[model samples]
Target: MRAFPAVAGNETLRNGLPGGLYSLLSHAEQYRLLCRRPDLIAPAVDELLRFWPPVVEFRRTATRDVVLAGKEIRGGDKVVVYHASANRDESVFPDPDRLDITRAPNDHVSFGFGAHFCVGARLARIQMSALIGRVVAELPGLELASDAPPKRLVSNFQNGLKELRIRWG
Candidate 1:
């Protein structure tokens, strides 16, 4: 119930990985892995969150009456933060549309800006990087097979490839 799908604009990890994406990690192991790789962690946690957003959209209530973006809102007003859209904000990420793997100091909002960040951020990165690294080391020129286009999930909420046909020596 915690994880969701990526969007059209959020395919960095998907395109970065080999054979498409693999699997999701449970909550317990997620924290354990992050704790292990303390040196290589970053807002890349943000990237994974962007790549595999937990919730398509989330709702929040205003703690106090306030006005936002030329709109007036009373206290307890409901607000929905689209994590996916926030991750692609041009103001936050220069050339937000581009998927640069080496993007450093990336403070993407996909994992929530503050304390609300995803719990499994660490494990997701370890698994993802491991897969990507394996492909690069084990199979150079690895690419999608030229038989048929990969299948789609048919749901925009979940941006995932149903299958990735690949061949490599």
Candidate 2:
């Protein structure tokens, strides 16, 4: 119910939409630098999610006692998995801090892992792709209006933006 109207819903969009748009524009800048390659859109979205995932972290209760990284974890313990940090792990991604749209085998956990993965992952990607494609097509020279910085919302669960200043004609 919170996302029934993603853009129009103040309660939800206010906390997410701006940050999403900021990330989308970041991808747009990359596209422009790469000479606006049509083949890069989808890959860029994947990279963007890895680089600046909207959901910062999530928790899972250990179903059974386990050992990870040489540490013992008891059953029923709450484990806070920082998806954003995992996405940038150097072992999984070489030069993980850099945004390379062509980065394949991304294996990013932005959408969670295994059975916990988001059910809306595919749909969300499609929508984002369409929006990015449309923006590039309709506004070939879209840009930020000024040098003003993006306003961010400090959050524990989500990486959010309060507002993003932009201009395009």
Candidate No. with top lDDT: 2
Per-residue CA lDDT of candidate 1, range 58-165, in tens?
Answer: 677888888877899888889888766876878777876654443575776544556566555555566666664454445544444567666654554444555666
**For model 2, how does the per-residue alpha-carbon lDDT over 55-114 read when each residue is reduced to its tens digit?**
778778999999998999999999999977898899899999887878898898877779
Q: What is the TM-score of each predicted model, taking all chains together?
A: 0.61, 0.82
Instruction: Give each model's whole-structure lDDT.
Output: 0.51, 0.71
For each of the candidates, give the backbone clash count.
0, 0
Q: Candidate 1 deviates by what RMSD? A: 9.2
lDDT of 2 at 131: 68
| Model 1 poorest ten-residue lDDT run | 19-28
**Cα misplacement distance, residue 74 of candidate 2 (Å):** 1.0
